[model samples]
Target: MCMPMTGARRSTSFLLALTTAAGASLLTGCGVLPGITGGSREPLTVMTWAPDGTQATNMPGMPATAVAFSRWVNDNGGIDGHRLKVLTCNEQNTNIGAGNCARRAVKEGAVAVVGSYSQFGSAFMPPLEAAGIPFIGGYGISGEEFTSTDSYPVNGGQAALLAGNGRQLARDCERVALVRPDTIDGDDLPPLINSGLTEGSRHEVADIRAADDAGDYSSVAAQALERAGAGPGVPARIGRSAARQQARKGCVTAVLGERTETFLDSFRRVETADQKVRISSVVGSVGQALIDSTGGKEGPFEGAYVTGWYPESGDPRWDAMRRVVDKYAFGDNRIDTDDAGVQTTWIAYTVLKQAVESLDKDSVSTRELAGRLDHGQPVTTGGLTPALRWDFASMLASADFPRVVNRSVTYQVVRQGRLVAQRKGFVNVGPTLENARTSG
Candidate 1:
């Protein structure tokens, strides 16, 4: 009810307001500031990053799944009533884009980067490492995920998938061809698949490298068919049916992430009934969802072999996650429950929640979370993964991928358009990897 005296009072008032607002902003950008902190009786913040809407490989489902998990947890009392704040970034599948996302996570005060995807580990790992931020449940796309001290991978990453695929293929195929990306990460794949092949006394894989983002893989498909089907060591072709061909003709397995479908399309076009070879891929590159979209029983993937880090999407272990998605992330089309990325994100978040819950407090530091996980904490993911424990003693005996703890992979095959288990339960490929490391 007092009248302004004009200039001096108004100017002073404005300056004071500006000062207060600036202070608030400073707090907002901190990794843990005031109410929104990794402290007791407070909210926790984390990030999930992945490439989306890119020309090359993309996993829109990973970040989308993280968003869904945040929505679900926050709605359901939020990890012991401390709300979960998830910040998602699109890495755009570039080195700079990955670095930028990591920097953003650091600036925005994320306690951890959880259940994310990026093949460019060399780009993103540095920022998080410098900030001492933990990376939990990454999609395991890069070698750095296995080597970096900050990374706590939920699965054996591509190493397990390829090695498992090798073991799976070796059991049946007369010859093996691996079509992988020509990137640095792709270089590591051949040795892994070979390790599994060695276990079954099969010959080394015919390593074929291709562009990850190619629009046309017809030539590559032709090459794969020739190398795998007519490679030097293969027996003279005598079979026609897929089942018969796999054991006599050969097997061609591609691990080209999102571009796998394109490769298969090319493979299908060049392939005739008499020239058919057994098709195969790891779970992240292929799943039931892809099988359905391609033509089910009549598709190229109808008789393909696929190796996975977890049970197939239809397993009852995923019921709880499905329930959460149906309740909170309803109609979010980006989330395909069958997607390996979506499943990884769900499990990664589950690990994070369990680590946080173990603290039994609202406040958590990056050290606290990492410490709890590193110190032999066993997280049960409702059977989504073999109860994961990342203690040093539990890790595998490989110098290349020493941090690997859960080295189990499921061997699956497409039957009647569905990716069902080829063999019952999880297959332990630790010895295969260990052998590969020794031979390398």
Candidate 2:
């Protein structure tokens, strides 16, 4: 997904020192604002961090999705009659790289910037905030991060939601062993998950740890097993003998790290068919790969209860997503819309596009963009995910966008290396935004 900047785009070195203050002043002094015609060609520039980074999947789905949306925009006469040009740069999760990228976008005069697949949006928040350029695709945990007053989270706040998955499992278990990855992927998740538990409902949390630096599943599995317990045929024991029995009784469960592939690798290294332990994970951990390899027929995870953020299997939204796939995804019909990353990316981009269209073209400044976003706006993306209503105050309070887009968590049962939705369709886990705090 790493796209090289076209020859028309500026180089990063010269871009870094470019100041938006001078650019704004230059626009004002030249009378560019008042004399600008509604019909003038102004390319809407987007700076995304998908291509180069620790989390880069090169899924071909994200960039493909962007291409489809851009094609649609162009076919419909473009944004406010100006041709929309996407200037993508791979920030590679470096502050210097991201800062340089933002400067280059501003230097090239991008009205809005879009990014995701990592924390680049948060890292670049200050610059974009100062430049007054709309920064979309940021999902930060800190209220201050979301309070940028210029940026808007296209995919909603993630820090709280990521943590909420662990909190939600507390009721079902008395003890949990948290085993996360030793990379940037699992950075913000552990702190939020541990702190969100209520006093009375708190469970015995095992040591929070990262997977081995070697990315070796055996060591990770060994460490997790040692924490749980060591017994005959019981690999990476994550529960005491009593806790193990209690796990069957719904008193303890294992909460693995964030990534789907990593979790599966560890599970495979330590799991046996006879091992009867209830495991829990977040939506981002849901993927066809896991469902096929571990959660499939004769796979290790036959009865895992996976918590998903969006409804995927048999979801009505997939009908619309199919339209998007047909129109944009490319030659392969096998694109996994069910993949959590793919779904989240799809919704994130759609929300950003809708936010862009909702703003008053005359005031395309980032502050106005953020303001328009904070208030309720109509988002019609024809996406596979439910419509998003970005309640900015709620978003501001919880380090998450406080809005409910249907309270359903798609749970699937693994059968024959495939996930088959249980007899229950999409299960409504109740409104996710009830705890959202907002100060009027």
Q: Whose TM-score is greatest here?
A: 1
Q: List pairs with backbone clashes in candidate 2.
A: 174-251, 225-236, 225-237, 228-237, 228-238, 228-239, 229-237, 296-417, 297-416, 297-417
Q: How does model 1 fare in lDDT?
A: 0.83
Q: Which stretches of candidate 2 lie over 4 Å from their true place?
A: 1-41, 51-60, 79-82, 120-122, 139-147, 154-158, 183-188, 195-202, 211-213, 226-260, 272-275, 332-335, 360-363, 376-440
Candidate 1, position 158, lDDT: 92
Worst 10 residues of 1 by lDDT: 31-40
- Number of backbone-clashing residue pairs for each candidate, in the order shown: 4, 10
Q: For residues 5-111, could you state the per-residue lDDT of candidate 2 as single tens digits?
A: 44535354225324566644543454333323433445565655444334423333444555565656665666555455666666655667667777887787776
Candidate 1 per-residue lDDT, tens place, 196-265, comes to 9887745789999999999989999888888886523323354233443354457899999889988888
**Predicted structure with the largest lDDT when compared to the true one:** 1
Listed in order, each prediction's TM-score against the native is 0.87, 0.69
